[model samples]
Target: MPPRDPSALVAEMSRAEKLSLVRGTADPAERATGYLPGIERLDVPPLRLVDGPLGVRAEGERATAFPATLATAAAFDPALAREQGAAMGREAVAHDQHVLLAPGVNVVRVPHCGRNFEYLSEDPVLSGTVGAALVDGIQSEDVIATVKHYVANNQETSRTQVSAAVDERALREVYLPPFRAAVAAGVGSVMTAYNRVNGTYMSDHADLVGGVLKDEWGFDGYVVSDWYGLATTVGAATAGLDLEMPGVPAPGAEDHEGEWPDGIPDAGHAGLFGDPLAAAIDDGRVPSERLDEMARRVLGQMARIGLLDGRERTGELDSQRHRDLAERVAGRGTVLLENDGVLPLADDADVALLGPHVHEAKLGGGGSSETTPFHSVAPDEGLRARADGTVTTARGVPPVPSRSLFDRLPYLDWGRDDEESDRPEPSLDDAVDAAADADVAVVLVRDATTEAEDRDSLALPGRQDELVRAVAAANDRTVVVLRTGGPVETPWRDDVAAVVEQWYPGQADGDALAAVCYGDRDPGGRLPVTFAPADTYPASDARQFPGVDGTAHYDEGVFVGYRHFDAAGLDPTYPFGHGHSYADFAYGGVTADGTDRVTVPVENTSDRPGREVVQAYVEPPTVEGVDRPDRVFAGASPVELAAGERREVTVSLDDLAVRRYDPDGGWTVDAGTYGIAVGRSARDDRASVAVDR
Candidate 1:
């Protein structure tokens, strides 16, 4: 039989049943991150929501752990991103989950944003395109994919209280594109951010949610507020928020990231969405039809996923295929930021592995994105397996402390922080000695970031900076590997022989590192976010960042990431899309068709296989009264080439490249000549073409 109509089911549901569908309830299995129970009499199954972007994060369950979304974004390969999404979807379904809270499309506005690792990119076109692919991949598995943190949720500091003062055009052009793309791709759900936009809580914002998203964009999915992110009952209900998560009030009501208060087990339930919503509807504070709409949306998603028909969903976990894919992504996403002929180390040479937790796999950053893999490979172990010569190890500094209050909590700590607590003390002298004695010294350092908090600075935490200097001084051939969630200031970049950016490459971290270091895999990753000093970004001011009083101002408009760098004429530590390869790729010639398409011929000049990301930037026409960036990232295509192979890469310009957001006219195309630059990075332009529109 076909899926039942959601309208009919909503008509049958009473007020109580409708309210139940609108709020989360207790999960009997206690495995899901969130749970929503439908009407039992109508046989509507409860939706099991799991925290998944990196992997399926069902409590106490093991799944295939993939790299950070930032890592995937670095690859600039949507095919890989979609594959990861499908793999995660299957894993969630294996654990009987219905909704996957994933594909966080929020633009990386702040380098210090603790949750930057969870997002895609600073450029909207890249983030939006990749995010939509993830949504398509997840929904293809018949699971509801949630595109989240709604709008302008850039910082983690005071996320629950601080308001992001974004203008209307900024929202349309900079922050809202990714969410819009996800919606356009037919994503099943939208998650509101825990923060506020322009002093109005997103959960209760009618103009954006109800008018812009639902009315203008025609998003036909349910709008669920983030856990404990709801503001008001009637306001949210009337504002087009279809669901409130966790059903009850959390343990620490004020602290969005805090644990359950004192004695509360699992999660608390104060029933804010339960009785309060019903009361509002009964007393006419909220329209009765709004409740019906909520129930219909929930049922609609269930029907779409085949849950209403009691379809059996089975998926593989810890499969060899998934394991290999994990390693493949980690390898492909490895960005070589700098090098001086010291990489792809000699297989027979003695190597010194020096860093904190060389024995532990740097899986990922903390909070909801964490996943417990069946097994993990440490860098030391992986290097030992791959290298033909002796591999000595020494800790360069004390282990970086995971500064999350939630890290100590039982249910939330899925990545096994307890196992890491009793680590042995490190000695700097031993590290220096090891470096001096070895043919090459590999120093691994990482910055700690987690949810519910923002990093104090872009500087590496603890004594790692000191450690890098010491090791570099001891051995001239010091190869520094940064296993961070996002960009960090490399104050000692010039001192090192080479620098590798392996952004939190999940469970296969060790294997990926070994392969890349030993020349088995080429550095295929590129900088997704620009590397800059702590104070160089558009929001360098205290008032613009963590905010003053109550609001954080977004005064820079559309100038974010490389756009900011270009407009301000400031050079970053490393430009966006900058990366190195063992093989060199030469661009022959580039031509554009005045509008939609740009064609470039590229060849691998070196005798090694390589992957090249062909990037195209568009310079919009000069409108007399309008102001725009120096250039906007249009689109890119990743090319795979064998040695001595020549191929033509076609990069289709994004429709939004020449468009400007007009408050009165919506997105409009300026009638003038447009310039398109084709290059490997934001700053390096290989060729240029003009378009008259």
Candidate 2:
């Protein structure tokens, strides 16, 4: 049968019917109660939508649970991410849901932001590439994938009202890239954020929703406001916002009476039934033809996603295929920061595991991003399972007392209260004593929670730096595993024998960590953001973030992360893309043809099989008037090579790479020498050719 024409459907509807189409009905029970008063009854049933980005999160029986977005991101495999999305799609179908609200694409701006783990990475390319893969995967199952928190939702505290006071360049370069990528990848819907961008609420920002997203980016999807994110109906509707989420009562209702309040002033309420839409139709504020066009896009997406045809199954949830992919990704995303030959621990070596995070695994970060897992493996259990020799563990820190990094460190808790809890705290003397007897000491220090939204300082949370120093001093072969959701100040970098940064690996994190430690899996992941020393940025100096007036100014502009460090000639503790493997890899055969592409040869010199992410950094020629520094021109494919295997990876540059943003929002490629470097991480690389534009 042919699909219902959206224009015909809209033309046939009354004002109430039009209103009903925009408001979502909660469930079958709610649908039958005439809860959506504006919707006119038709032969066709109302579509059902579910809450999510992680998985189908409706409170019901037999709903398949998947890993959180952070956990999935830690896997760092696009195929694995796609499989996760497909699984969510299948579950959404089972639950009779038309839209799956997910794949939150917010950038991880600060280490302490509450919901940092829910996003992919700090790098726009990494986040966008991964998000696009996931979006494609979900939509492949014929389910609508709604990309969320539209722009600049970097923090959770006061998120509904806080203004992300970023400049136009930073906003375009950092905050908006991922959403643009998702839109380009064919996402069905876009969810407006609760927060404001600059001085305007996301739902009411005509420049963002109307000017940029729709007109500039050529996004054809309907924009829906975050649940209650809309403060004014008139402003939102005029800004090209198509839907109000979670279904709010019509204009001027009193105390759940489901009727307009008596003597309610027009207050723009006269335009409630899209009278503005009708007036806009008459006066050309909005063309009547455009309304049909918008409606058509919505219905077209609905039909494309199988919502109109009824729910369809694409794949089974939590199948062996998905589990295998999950395990592979979990292993791949682990980054081995440092190794001092103590790792690949000899089967006969005695291993003493110390730290609060050892037995009590800190898998995922807190917030709506949390997931109910089928199971989670712990480090001690994984270590014990693999060890042929003895493995002893001592409770070094308590999980509850202080969740910050300082609280878990031995000397940092000297004068704190609440000393009488069941949670054990290892003293400096005790930790030293334990290390004296052990051949190797593994200290699992966790710095997961940071000051959400607003961080007072960039200092390491607790006595973790002290604990790491003390433990490393006591034992020659000490391995420090720093588990955190974002970057931390690692001042004692030179002291520790080995340091591994495990960014909030999800439920199966323990197993993933163990896999990297035991050399069962090589750490292929790299730092997506730069790790600077404590008190680096201007925000750190002010001792306030998101500011008092609910606005955060990005004074750093384009110089974010490594870009800042490189341009300013400052050294970070760990530069972006800094990760080490047990095996050695070499980069050579660097060749670039000035205009389109660069190719590099990657050789695996070690005896073990591994993958190397060949990052290509570009330094565009200086323009007389352009004030911006160098940008990442191109990056090569992630080369997965076996022992003694060599492969050539080619990187292609686009017009955006060489383009410099003008003051008036235009991009121009300056004619100059561009440096092309290839390496495992940003800090460790070999450069060869320079492209002259």
Candidate 3:
């Protein structure tokens, strides 16, 4: 094959060549392979790609592993996520991959969302910030990073057909921000979602793909279809979806064996080279210039990434640095949701671990987000290694249907011989009785695995809530550690002596959890989403969620999570940005320069070293036609402080800082005095200052 200009090659190619260019070829070793018979004459070697947002996931070959997206968000360190991306990019280059289909930026809206492990957090700002950083890191290593599931792909169940009927405000505020941020960060490619936004499929949605992504956001990258996500090649191609992944074979071609036949369709059916492109050209559905432009963009990305410069390597696939990053991210992403001085157990303290989650640690979720971890560490093993006393782990409660009060009652036996209403009487008495002899009981609670995304309700699943309540009733010094990807309703928040939320920390997650509890490390992570009571949920009415017509309407608008709870004047079980540390910290003397700077002194008041994330929120006085949250997170800074150490942190605010997206359209700053509050969590405030905009 000659080294031809990508544009010239695209222009000179027949229908078959164009089809082959977009479809991914299968690995030689795989029995099931996709063969593109249309472009045999092009004589171009097909580029091999694989599934991944974290690492290359081609079977039969080992690849470097990185922490899951959720784990990276827990780090609260953009630099670290970016470094992980760079490592993944190097691995991609080593594998001779043209694109890395990853950096899943979908927001973690609900706890039971099956794909939550693959995503970052419920907060758009957090997800976007980390996603942008990762994109920068991946591209830096001279490999293309594909930011994916373009819009409103929070859940996995019925994802292909589900219609995300979100309001404009919610769409802009929650669902779309991450992609916008990723585009701004210069990701090389964007993959459209499998579901529909409103009523239009993402691949064929002109407004989303062409209008918002390409025009408004100024994204110059190529758009690819999620595998088999495109209904028709013409519709997708015309809608700015540049590639049809896993190319369909032509009709009657004996050499090819797979889905999509070989041979051009009859004149009426619009053959690959015939009608769609030709008709598209005639009706102005697609201009030749658009095709030329797409080819240029692809070629340009290749050149900029040094893919055309022969800089790719095969040895960079699994480096030590990549493995180290995976461990670091996994360690940092673990969150200590609650603790009452019981944590960081003394080396000599006797510990009793309980719960099914202890032995079967759910690291990451199912589907595209799943990664073959380099190694997995069980919490029981991790804790046993450091404990001086015998670490006795008891299966307190068997795997039951209910994890919380909100789960469907009268558990149906779907996997049983008969569909009997055999609801196992909520029993924690036996588990509590067993814990009577132990000094400290560590109860582990596991969330649902890959079956569904987002919870039917805010409550925890199964009788786990009942179990927690009973165990807490029996044992006063009980600690509950929740292993879930998203926020679960915690009615038993006040009962448990201590709590820790490990958001599906990938692979080495068990070790990270054990390390935090054993004082091997301090917990510095915070919640990315607000945990509201079931009654206070925006879609509190059962009929309001998932809608009647199979379309979920985002009636909450600009107010989501803490935004909705705060605006509605409702209290949450745990507010966003809420996380506790073993040591105490104080915020004093917060002053914002009338212009663009705010300086505050953060003092570690406790007698121990710890890290504190200082959050700044702005509350604009009521304004007409503004559906803005009273308190919006404007700035956040993480500080490491020693005992009694005071550090002065300065935060800058500009026009964008106080600006809110007007309900009508565009962004506008209200001409009123705004309240600037500094806090450890959304509900927990320390000091307030007035700022005039």
Model 2 per-residue lDDT tens digits across residues 1-693: 455555566677665466555554445443111122223254344555566664565543333334346545544456767877877777667655667777888877765565665677766766787788789888888878889889988766667677878888878776788899899999988999887888898988999998999999998777876654665655677787877665544333333342212111111222232444555556766655555655556666766765554544554555565555555566676667778778767777788787755675454554334444555667788788877777887754444333332232222233545522545555666766677678888887765452233344455555666667777788889988877666767777677678887766555666667777788887777777677875554234332355566776667676655666677777777877777777778877788877577888889999988877777766677667656755562454566789999988886654445666665857666676877776665666675677787
Model 1 per-residue lDDT tens digits across residues 213-298: 89999998999988867888877888899988877654454354344432122334345678888889779998888888888888
Name model 3 segments beyond 4 Å from true: 1-5, 8-15, 29-45, 60-68, 94-96, 109-112, 249-285, 314-323, 400-434, 451-454, 457-463, 593-597, 652-657, 663-665
**Model 1 weakest lDDT span, ten residues long:** 261-270
Candidate 2 weakest lDDT stretch, 10 residues: 260-269
Please give, for residues 482-546, the per-residue lDDT of candidate 3 as tens digits. 77756777778788789887776665666676778876667877777666666676755534454
lDDT of 2 at 298: 66
What lDDT score is found at residue 553 in candidate 2? Answer: 66
Every candidate's lDDT: 0.87, 0.66, 0.68
Q: Which model is ahead, 1 or 2, in terms of TM-score?
A: 1
Query: Candidates' TM-scores?
Result: 0.96, 0.85, 0.85
Stretches of model 1 off by over 4 angstroms after superposition: 250-270, 408-423
